[model samples]
Target: MAAPSPRPAGSYGMDASWVPWLWAAIGIVYLVLAGFSVFSWGAPLWVTFLVAVLGLAFLAGGALFWNASAHGKFLVWRELLDELPAPARVLDLGCGRGAVTIMTAEAFPRADVTGVDLWRSIDQSGNSPAAAEANATVNGVSGRTRFVTGDMTALPQFDGGSFDLVTASLAIHNIHSPLGRRSAIGEAWRVLSPGGRLVIVDISKVDEYIVHLRALGAALTVRRAGWRMWWSGPWMATRILIAAKPGASS
Candidate 1:
């Protein structure tokens, strides 16, 4: 097998690259229709104007999404991780291609990071355990990083309170079912050591996660994930959640 390319600093594969591609494709179609209406069909002025505006808007949105996926998202995660104390053990849920996993390793130099994911391509293009492993290699965290093909809702390989820090980024929403997502959050909470921290960034079902964690007796605080985490626009923006498990660390 060929060797993995060394991913450069600040260089990471796209997260849901298809989302932006779909946006750009739709924008192109709209622009084409607008051109056809203006030149060949002599369609209504308002119709042409509307389509043209939509085309430009969609294209702009697509560019933003692409930028955010490639660069902005990592910057945001790095910034978020920087504010916390160094963790000795970290668990990254749904660590597609190791963006957050590698970030955690870099953020906490002494930490041993483990990533778990189902590696579905629909969730992230080129998603695979090997891809995640290669990313860790290229990012110079291979020695301290590992990837496992597993579902977040049920992490059988790990014991409860196994990690000092748990993180999920743009991953939990993929569960599709509310109960399943809640279970995943419960699992994250389960694997956290006492006084350990759980940080999640997701675009959907934020309220459900917060409520579930609150019910579990976690001290929860949440806020907007900011524009860098916006998948397409503000309407689809992600949020960051920080939950602290009770009791002191052993």
Candidate 2:
């Protein structure tokens, strides 16, 4: 068998075009809050009130940015989907813009698919509930797909061992730290049934990926694919890591 070609580098990264507008908005908000602080000078009541409002705004904006980037990465879901099985139950973790969720439904017409995400308007991209619904309908697989808005760390809506496959494409790298990645992996493991499989794709190094999977009690297999290969084999290059839950007789 021919070796899979390596996926293109530099195809991943955040778009910076909106940075100017974002900064401008933040600057304007800061100025408005500063004026409020000046007017409230010695009045402890106004000072505390203004500070709290500004702090909350900042927190909300930060969250919006994070969500936007997460949603934007949904553009790459098609590449990840090629590795999954047909007629399988699929759970898309951090499914922003619902791209993979919809794609999975379409790719496996008999499968039941669910997409879970926080669905912040700013980060939703084309993977929102509405988008997922629309895509599924257009692809003639609406009946098999559902999109839900919720927390990824605690997926209470889903039952344990519910899905045949769990996918977290370009999501693991967005986690804040190593510990956060482990937590997310643990959650993925918890939801997978015995004999279920997981595929996680991120910009992370293979070693880091292995460590995280090991921590979650998963075995790992990595491969790459993309366009412009030697053409003796698979042209698509990707870093694919496949893991199965322990206790399977296979």
Candidate 3:
């Protein structure tokens, strides 16, 4: 892996990255320009109304993004860790910034967690394996955590049923295509040993994810996560799916 930047544990560590701020900035700029035009050039009243609506929307979007990505994710992951068994081998899919992955390693000293991510720049600012490594090192779990540059749809390094626990935190929804999403779910199921547990958090299409898991003959439960999962209220439509491969104690 490439050397990580010399940042504290939190350097580039926010759950939602620059995108929300960018949207808010755009809205604020629009509002400012519209206000200037209205005062100096006597722009239309509807222009003011439009800018107000758009500006508020953008601000709300930014706030929601912050709540969902940072605080809410921490809460959800903490609770999930409590619910998970003491896994010997853990696989974290789409482990951005090493939040869940490092936390998993920290929580279970016996488990060696492998974090896999495509690390797309669009997903988060400074999202990379090196950033993840830095986060792990800062958290002092670097010994138990490993960052892998790879896709969720195909995990070639890990053999079938190798992981005792699998987790994906707000990561899979970025896969816009239906096929890729299914492949990710299938690959998680395939790589886990029988009775292994899989947990996922996504903004949308988790019902489909649960369906795919059920089709694989795994026992599963789906919940519309509470406010702890999404601080923007329930309208944001966040969901969590917990599934387990058969032949293990439930």
| Highest-scoring model, lDDT | 1
Model 2 residue runs over 4 Å out of place are 1-83, 121-127, 225-238
Ranking by TM-score: 1, 3, 2
User: What is the per-residue lDDT of model 3 for residues 1-250, given as tens digits with 9 covering 90 to 100?
Assistant: 9954222256555655676678689779877877886888687989877877887777777777777665667767776788778999999998878888877887798899999998887776678888888888888989999998898998888899899899998888888899999999999999888888999988777877988988899888777767755534466767778898997652
Tell me the tens digit of each residue's lDDT in model 1 across 13-104.
Answer: 67777889899999999999999999999999999999999999899889889877876777778779888888899999998888889888
lDDT of each: 0.87, 0.62, 0.81
- TM-score winner: 1
Instruction: State every prediction's TM-score relative to the real structure.
Output: 0.92, 0.60, 0.83
Off by over 4 Å in 1: 1-12
Candidate 3: clashing residue pairs, number: 3
Report the Cα lDDT for residue 153, model 1: 94
Q: Which stretches of model 3 miss by more than 4 angstroms? A: 1-8, 14-18, 29-54, 228-235
C-alpha RMSD for every candidate: 4.3, 12.8, 5.4
| lDDT ranking from best candidate downward | 1, 3, 2
lDDT of 2: 0.62
